[model samples]
Every structure is written in C-alpha cells, then in structure tokens.
Target: MASPLKVVILGGGTSGWMCAAALSAILKPGTPSSILDLRLIESADIGTVGVGEATLPHIKEFNDFLGINEAEFMRKTKATFKLGIEFRDWGQVGNSYIHPFGTFGQTLAGVEFQHYWTRAQALGEAASIEDYSYAIQAARGQKFDFPSEDKESIKSTFSYAYHFDAGLYAAFLRDFAEARGLKRTEGKVETVALKPDSGDIASLTLASGEVIEGDLFIDCSGFRGLLIEDHLHAGWEDWSRWLPCDRALAVPSERTDDFPSYTRSTALSAGWQWRIPLQHRTGNGYVYSSAFISDDDAQKALLANLDGAALMDPKPLRFKAGRRKKSWYKNCLTIGLSSGFLEPLESTSIYLVQIAVQTLIALFPSSKPGEPIDDKLADEFNRLIDIEYERVRDFLILHYHANTRTDSALWDYVRHMNVPDSLTHKIEQFKRRGYVKKYRDGLFSPPSWLAVFIGQGVVPHGYDRMADTMDDATVIEKLADMRVRIRANVDAMPDHADFVRDYCFVPPAKVMAEVSK
Candidate 1:
C-alpha cells in the first residue's frame, strides 16, 4: 500500500473544519479508510471573525456532500431557513426588494417570464415583479417549507440556505471531522519555513518549538495568508476602488418572536447594515467605508438600528475587498480569509470557502509521494479561484453602482464611479431590453441579476422581441394569475418560527426564554 500524504491545515474557523470534513468525506468514500493523513493546527489565542451567519443555497449541497443530516445540523448550529435576502432602502428611502434563491414565474411560451412581465409593465398592466416569485412571497409572509421535489409544483421553484452561529458551526464540524480521524493540534504557529529550491512551504514551527511538516499546506489563517502570501509572496489584489466598504462593526442582539425567513440588508448613510436571524440571537452588522464614516459613528448606527437589546459589545473587523492574485501558490493552497476577501454583502464568505475546498478536491494532486509538485494543477486551481472571485466581485459592484440613493457622498461616488467594462456591458445590454448574460458556470443567475436591476429601478426600454408575441391582455392576465398562485402557496406554508420548532428545534436557554413569552 502507498504511504498516506500528510496534509496540514492552519487555522480552525468555519473554513478549516469545512475543509477537514469535506476532505475526510472524499478520502473515506464508501467506507472509513484514509488516503490522506490530515491534521489542523488552531490556536486558542487567535480569534476568528465570526460574523458570517447567512449563506447562499449552495451551502446545502456542501452539507449533503459531507453526509450531514439537515435537521441535526440545523439544530446544532442554531440555524434558520433563508429563502432570500431583502434589500431595504437601497433604491430610495423605504424602498424594498427581495433577491430570492429561486426563479421568477415559469416560462411563458418558452420565453422567460421576466420578458412578459416587462411587456406588461410597459403597457401599464403589471404589478411589481416581486408579486410573481414564490420565494419572495413566502419570505415576505414569514413562511417556511422545504422545496417540493415535483417539478410542476410552484413550491419547487425556490431553494433555501441557512442563518447560523458561525462559531457554533465551526465547533459542530470540528466534532464531525474529529470523529472521522482528523487530528487537532492547539498552539500558535511561531514561524513558517519554506523549501530552499522549490520555495514551497516545508514546515511550520510552533511557539513551543515543535516543527510540523506536510506534503501539502492549506492556509485558513484570516486575512494574513500566513503561508500562501506571507511565505510564498503571492500578491494581494486590492479592489477597494470597486468595493470600498472596508470595515464592519458586528454585534449580536436578542432574538425576537418574529423570525423572518430572509436576511435583510438595509441601506444606511455611508454603507449598509445586515440583519441575520438565527435561532439563538440575531446577528447585526454595519459594513461601511471608513473613508466616509468614522468607526465610532458606524458602531453607534449599528447599535441604534438593532432589532433588540444588544447581547455583546460590537466587535470591529477591518478588511480590503479583494482576493489574492493566486490562491494556490506551489504546494500551499490558501482557503478562507487567508485566500482573499470580498465583503459579505451577498453572504459569499462561507460560500467562497466551500468553492475553494471543493475546487482543490476536484484538482487534487496526482503526483506520488516524494515527487515534484504539479505546477499545472496549481495553475488550474488558481484560474478557477480567479473566475469565482471576479464573478462575485462584479455582482457585488452592481449593488453599489445601480443605486438611486443621493443622500450621501458614498452613494454619489459609487453611482458615478467608472465601473469595469465587463459590468458596463452587462448593464447596457439589460437596459436595451430585459436580458441577462447567461454563464456556463458561476454565481448569480439571471433571476439574481433581474432582481437587482429591476429592484434598483433600472427599467428596460423593451422586452424580448419574442415576448411581443403575447398580447398585453394575455400577458397581464397570466402575470396576475401567477401572482395569485404564489400568494396562495405562501399562505399555505407554516410560520418560519413554527417550522423551526417542529422540524429541528434545539432549545437553547435564550431561545427558550424568548419562546416562553
């Protein structure tokens, strides 16, 4: 039998355990056997920025890949269902829209329902596009239900993610990985050493002077990129000009009885505030550009707007909105914050970690022990990482640029800023008609783009020429009918809180206290 490959992962946050769990699943497929010897080094002194509470629907697939039981995982993490994100006051004061994890109404005559909706709007016969989405209606109604498997069912249109305690989630996955033979070493990494010839990471020396070596190094260290950047000299790509919100003040507050099914991002003066409700408490944060708003003022704004009494003092996190020039450098692969950062506007922080780990697994090295590392495989990994980061970067930029808010300098600057030509072409194409550029693979589908564009008041001049075939009366009638069906389906679903209780409730002390009232 071949000797096991030694895999060393630095840092132990959500990213570390996610990598450990997923890698364990991959190596021990079908039965419990190890192809890789995995060990994670995490420090008690180092802290993780635990504000990533909300997630996209892709997280469900990651959990399923690890063979996790959804109900058990939710209970352990204090999670709540997230059907979509609701943007409040982004277009104008009091304006609101939901970017759902689902499609708009089903195709009308083989054309996307949005084109028909656009035609009806031009004829002054349509309602807000929000009325035609099942996820949006259910979210607005504070309802919850697992998506139906039946393709023809309206309830099957949407997918769901989760809002959970990031810290608890890490611990949950720690138990999972540890049970599957993942070793955990607790100590601070004093220094990282590199090979003289290859320049790849050779070993990490602990504060206690213990040297640990590995064939492969996974950097999960936050922001610092301890191995991938600090040791290998992989460059950081600054994206502050495009995504300028460089600081965040995160805090937790008491959970309220009304647990909405969607995360909310309310536009503030200089930036935006996010409200993510889990079962135990609500996670709140104000992400702002320090160039525009003072840190003290940002903290004040965040505290003032929370849904309930603050549970802890607000903790500040500073980060640039960009990624590493090369996420995979030589034999070291950077995962999580060590790799790079794009702000958590769309809850892509955890999703990005999942993608990196999954990508590495797909492009796992084929070289035998004691052979040279494959440069071609590492380059391919970096390429995939670049595509994911850039695609997400553009989507986030659209949120900042497609705004109508003129109340602050931040808004004015972003609204008029010179966006990338890629984004420029997309917006122009959408404005000419109701169209969205389709991707073979990436985040943010057509419905996602449509939600943002139409929600921010970007009205197209024309519909798809194909949509013109439908008469105005017919289009209006069908849209209205779709709205009726969406509302009825949403109305039939259970309350979000009640569903959590009946399905996978974990009665934490705080949650129980809130429920008693």
Candidate 2:
C-alpha cells in the first residue's frame, strides 16, 4: 500500500483548524487505510486575525458535513442566526436594502422575477423589490425560523448564516480536530527549507529547534502568506486601485437588547462600518482607506457610531485588497487571508476558506512514493481558487463602484473609478435590462447581484420581452400578493432574540469562565 500523505498546516485560528478538522475527519488520519498524516503548527505569541465574525449560509453545510450538532456549535461559538446583510447608504445616503441569502419572487414563465418587477416598476405599479423577498421581510421584522423543507412554501425561500465569535470558533474546531487525530504543535515556524531538486517545501523548522517534514503544506498564515509567498515566492496581485480599503478598526461592543437576525453594513464617510451582532456582544468595525482617512479619525468614527458601550479598545488591522497570483503554487496551497483579501464587505472571508478547503479535498493529490505531485492537480486548484476570488472581488467592488455617496473622497473616487471589464460588463448588462450574468459555480448568484444592483439604484432601462407575457394588472396583483404572504409569514415567526434564547443561548457567566480558561 502507498504511504499516507504527510500534510502540515501552518498557522491556526479559523482557516488552519477548519482545514485540520475537515481533513482529519474525511481522510481518517490514523485508520488502517489512513490517507493522511496531518499536523498543525501555531504559536502562543503569534495572534490570529480573528475579526471575521459574520458568515454566509454555506457554513452550516460545512458544520453539517462534520456532523457537528448545530445548537452545540452555536452555543460554543456564541452565535446568532443571520438572515441576510442590510446595507445602508451605499447607493446614496439614507438608502437601505438587504442582500438576502435567498432569491426574490420566483421566475415567471421562464423569465426571471426581476424582469417582471422591472416591467411593473416602469409602470409605477410595484413596490420596492425588497417587498417580495421572504428573507428581507424576516430580517426587517427581526424574526428567525429555520427554512422550511417544503419547496412550495414561502418560508422555504430564505436561508440563514451566523454571527459568532471568531476566536471561540477556532477554539471549538481545535477541540474537534484534536479529537479526530490531528496533532497540533504549540510553536512558531522559524524558517522554511526547500528541496534542491523540485524546489517545493521540504520542511518547516520551528523556533524550538524541532524540524517537521511534510509532503504538502497548507498556508493559513494570514496576510503574510508565510510558506506560500515568503518561502515559495508566489507573487501578489494588487487590487488596491479598485478596492483601496487597506485599514480597519474592529472592536466589540456590549450586547444590545435588539437582536436582529441580520448583519448591518452602514456606509460612512471615507469608508464603511460593519455591525455584526453575536449572542454575547455586537462586533463593530470601521473598514476605511488609510489614504482617504486618518487612522485616528477612523478610530473615533467607529467609537462614536457603536450600538452599545465599547467592550474593548479598537484593534487595528492593515491589508491590501487583492489576492496572491497563484493560490496553489507547487505543493503549498494558500487558504484564508494568505491567499487574498477582498475585505469582509459581504461576509465572504469564511466562505472563501471553506471553498479552498473543499476544493483541495476534491482535487487531493497522490501520496505514492517516488511519484511527483501532479502539477495538473495544482493547476486545477489554482484555476478554481482564482475564479472564486475574482467573483468575490467583483461583487465587493460593485458595492463601492455603484454608490453615489459624495460626502467623502473615498466614496467619490470609488464611484467613478475604473473597474474590471468583467464587472463593467455585468453592470452594463443589468442596466440595459434586468439581466444578471449566471455562473455554473461560485458566488454572487443572480439574487445577490439583483439585490445590489437594484438596491444601489442601478435601474434597468428595459425588462425581458418575455416578462410582457403576463398582463400588467396580473403582474401588479401577483406582486402585491407576494408582499402580503411574505409579511404574514415573517410576522408569524418568533422574535430573533427569543428564538436564539430557546435554541443556543450561552450564559454570560459560562462565556466568561470559558474565556478565563
């Protein structure tokens, strides 16, 4: 039998542990036919960038794949249900809309609901496009409920994610991964040695003078890229001109009484502020461009706009807005912040990590002795990771480029700045008609684009000709009916806070005790 593949993951926190847990669980590390020998190296001195608190609904699938109890995970992570994200003042000041986890009204006669809504909107007969969405209604009402399994039911139209403590989540996964035969070393990597023949990563030397050798290395080292960039010299691609938000000040605030079921991204001068409400506290941050705003001003802005009393001093983070030239270079695969950063505008940081881990597992390489790791596998992996990053990049850029906020130089510059041809084509297509580009796989689905386009005032000049199949009066009636049904359904659901209390409420005393440990 071929020997098991030796895999060493650099760094810990969310990405490393997630990879560890998933790899250990799926590959069955110590079994008779064990395919993987996995270990992770992290240090007490090196801190993780644990600011990612909001997540996409895909997280549930990851957790479910690990067979984790949802309620228990939530309790341990201090999580709360997230229906969608509510954006304020991105299109223009005081304008608000939700990028829901689900679709708007159903397709009509092979034409999208957006086309029909556009036609109705032209006639001034339809309400805001937000009216037809079950998720938006539920979010607006501060309600929570599990999506129904019945596809025909309106309640089934929406999905949910979570707002949790990132630090706690990593710790939770650490326990999980360790239980499944993942060996974790509490030391920092001091140097990386490369093979003279293949030039791939040969071994990692720790500060404690211990050397660990592995066939494959996964870099989750955040921003620095550690093995992927520093050691392997996988180039960087700078999207700073288009994205430009290079600095952030994140701080936790006291928990508020109002427990909404969605994250809120409120646009501010020079940049934006994100409010993510967890079970224990509200996660708040001001993501701003250092070139456009001073760090001192950004810190003051974050403190002034918080929903509750500040729990801790604002923690500053600096990053560029782009990705590595190659996510998978040679034998090292970069995941999480190491691969790239598109900011957390749409809560896609965790999703990106999840996708990389999933993709790596899907295209897992051979472990046979004397056989080279197929370059084709690495090529395909890089291709997929590139697509995911580009898609997310375009989506995040849309939030800034489509805005009309003239109050700050940051907003003004992004409003008129040149974007990628791919994004420009999408914008033009949507504006000409209510058309959204479809992807066979990856993110920023039609519904997500529709929400951002319409929400940000990118009104269509025409609708799909097929939308005219339905008479004007009938379209208006159907629109009104959808609104009524969504409103009624959301109203019937339990309050978000109440639902959380019943489902996964973590006591403050318990949280403190756990933290002390």
Candidate 3:
C-alpha cells in the first residue's frame, strides 16, 4: 500500500479542532490508515475570537456526518436551538421581520403559494407572506420542535440550527478529535520551514524549538494565515471599500429572560448590533465601521442594549471582509477565517469552515501532488469559495443598501451605494416578478430569498400569470386555510425555554466565598 499522508493543521480554535475532529472520526486512530494522519497545533496564550455563537441550518448535516449526538453536543456546548434570524429595523426604522429556516406556503392549485398570496394581496384580501410559513409562525412564538424525517408532515417544513458558546464548542470538538488519535500540540508556531527546491512548507518550528514535519499542511490560523499567507505569501483581496464595517466588540452576559429561538440583528447608526441567546448566556456584539464610529462609542453602544448584566467587558476584534487570492497553494490548504471572512451577517462563518473541510476531503490527494498541486483543483476551489463570499456579501449588503435608516452617515452612504451586478439583477428580478434565482451550488435557497426580500418590503410587481387561472375567491379561501394549518402546527411546539430545560440546559455560574467541602 502507498504511504499514509501526514496532515498537520495549524491553530486550534474552532476551525482547527473541527478539522481534527472530522478527520479523526472518519479515519482509524493509530492504525496506519490509508492516506490519513491528523494533527493540530495551538497555543493557550493566543486568544481566539468566539463571537460566532450562532450558526446556520446546515450545521446539522455536518454534525450528523460525524455521527455526533445533537443532544450531547448541545449540552456540552451550552447550546440553544435556533429557528432562524430576526431582522429588526432593517428594511425601515421601526420595522421588523423574521427570515425563517424553512419554506413559505406550499404550492396552491398548480401555482406557487406566493403567487396566489400576491394576487389576493394585490386585491386587499390576503395577509403578509409570514402567515403561510410554519417556521416563521413557530419562531414568532419562540417555539421549536425537531424537524420530522417524514417529508409529508408540516413539521418537515421546519429546520433549525444552534446558538452555542463558541469557546465551549471548540473544547467539545477538541475532545472528539483527541479521542480519535489526532495529536494535539500545545505550542505557538515560531516559524514555518519551507522546502527550498519546491517552495512548499516542510516543517513548523514550535516556540519550544521542536519541529514537526508534515507532507501537507492545513492552515487554520485564523485571519493571520500563519502558514498560507505569512509563509506561502498568498495575496489578499480587501473588500473594506465595499463592506466598510471592520471592527467588532463582543461580550457575553448572564442569560436573560425569554431565551430567543433566533438570533437578532438590529440596525444601528454606523453598523449593526447582534444579540445571540445561548442556553447559558447572551452574546452581544457591535460590528461597526471605524470611519463612522469610534471604538469607545462602539463599546458603549454594545453595552447599552444588552438584556442581561454584563459578564465580561467587551473584547474587540478587527478584520477585513475578503478572501485570499488562492485558498490552495503549493502544499498548503487554508480553511476558516485564514482563507477568508465574508462576515457573519447570515451566520455563514461556521458553515464556510464546514464546506472548506468537505471540499478538502473530496479533493484529498493520494500523494503530496507528485508534480505540483493541481492548478485546476485549486482554481475550482477558489471559484466556488468566491461565489460563497460574493453571494453572502450581497445578502449582507442588501440589509444595508435596502434600508430606510436615515439617522446616520453610514446609512446615508450605503443607502444609495451601488451593488454588484449579480445582486442587482437578483433584486431587480424579485422586484419585477417575485422570482428568486437559486445558485447552481451555493447556500441560500429560494425560500430564504423570499423571506428576506418579502420581509423587507421588496414585494413583486406581479404574480405568475397562471396564478390567475384559479378563481380569485378560491385562491383567497385556500390561502386562509393554509394559514390556519400553519398556525396549528406552530402552536403545538414546546416553549423555547422549556425545550432547553428538558432537552439540554447549562446552568449559569455563581461565585462564593466558602468551599462546601
């Protein structure tokens, strides 16, 4: 048999551990498996940004693929179920709406439900599109139920993710990986030694003067890209001009009343504020533009609206929104924030990392590229990631550009700014006919587009002409019945707080002066 490949991953935050955990679970530990040897290096001194306590709906598949138990993972990570996201004051100030996980109403009488809803809406005989979405109804009441395996059930219309402590999540995955024979090195990387002839990394020198060698390298070094960028010199494409908000001040607080089943993004003057509720605590942060808001003011704004008492003062982080020119180069593959950061606006951060890993596994080479890393493979990978970035970028920009918040300079600038042709086309297509374009392979689906576009007041000019084939009165009656059915499904779900208590709960911390023992 051919020699097993040695894969050394740099850094040990969420990305490193996730990669380790995944590879370990897939390959036999200490068995000289075919083309697999996983190792991760990290330092306790270097702090990790755990602000991404929220996640998208795809996380379930990732966990499931690894055979991880959802309840155990949630309990260990202090996680709460996430139905979707709620946009507050995004379309217009004082206006709010939810972008739920699942689809809206089912097709009605040979026409999409939205079309009939729109036709009735055009005649003042229908309610907003939210009425037809079971997921949206459930989210509104702060409720949750496990999505059904049976596709025919209305519960199948509901999908959910998780809201957890990012730090604890890293810890959880670290255990999973270690138990599977992935070596965990606790040290800072001092230098990346390269092969003078091939221009590929040969070994990494730890701060302790120990050098660990590998056949291939995985760069999980956060935004610094210690191996991919610092060593290999992969260039970056800065998108701050298009997405100006560059700083984030995050803080965790005691769990407040009424744990929300969805993350809340409330628009602000210079940028926006996020409120993420976990089973243990609430995560608060302000993603703001340095040009418009000072760090001092940003921190103040982050503290002002927190529902619970502050546990720790805000810790700030700065990042540019963009991707590396090449994610795979020579013998190094960069994943997570090291490869790119598209902002966490849509909770795509963790999902991005997951995709990168899955892609690496699919494209895993048998030998360290006997000649050179396949340019075609690298090119295709970059292309796909670029689409991932741009598509999500546009969605985030939409929240800014399509808003009516005129209270600040930042809003004024973004309100009239030009967007990419692709996003522009999408918005135009939706506005003209309520038609949403799904990517050949990308994250958001049609219903996601409808949720945000319709929730934010981008109603269609007209519905499918075929929708008129149905009697107007019948269409109205059917829509009414659908709303009733959706409401009944949502009303049967358990309360969000009760679900956490019974399923998985993490108790808050307490400080005392004496030891019971």
Maximum-lDDT candidate: 2
Per-prediction backbone clash count: 0, 0, 0
Q: How does model 1 score by TM-score?
A: 0.97
Residue pairs clashing in model 3 are none
Per-candidate local distance difference test: 0.89, 0.92, 0.84
The regions of model 3 sitting more than 4 angstroms off are 368-371, 508-517
- 10 residues in a row with least lDDT, candidate 1: 26-35
What is the Cα-based lDDT of residue 489 in candidate 1? 81
For candidate 3, lDDT tens digit of each residue in 174-234? 9888887888889998888899899988899999999998877999889999988888999
Error of 2 at 187 (Å): 1.0
Worst 10 residues of 2 by lDDT: 365-374
Give lDDT tens digits, candidate 1, residues 1-517: 5667788999999999999988877785223345688889999889998889999999999999998999999987889999999999998888999999999988988898888987887788888888889999999999999999999998899999999989888998999888878889999999988889988778899999989988889999999988887788899999999999999999999988869999999999999999999888899999999999999999999999998999889999999988888888888889999988988889999999999999989988767655667899889989888888898999999999998888999999999999988899999989998789888767789999999999998888887899888777888888888889888889889999999999988878765663455
Query: Which regions of candidate 1 fall more than 4 Å away from where they truly are?
Result: 29-33, 510-517
Name the better of 1 and 2 by TM-score.
2
Q: Model 3: how large is the Cα RMSD against the reference?
A: 2.4
| Model 2 TM | 0.99
CA RMSD, predictions in order:
2.4, 1.0, 2.4
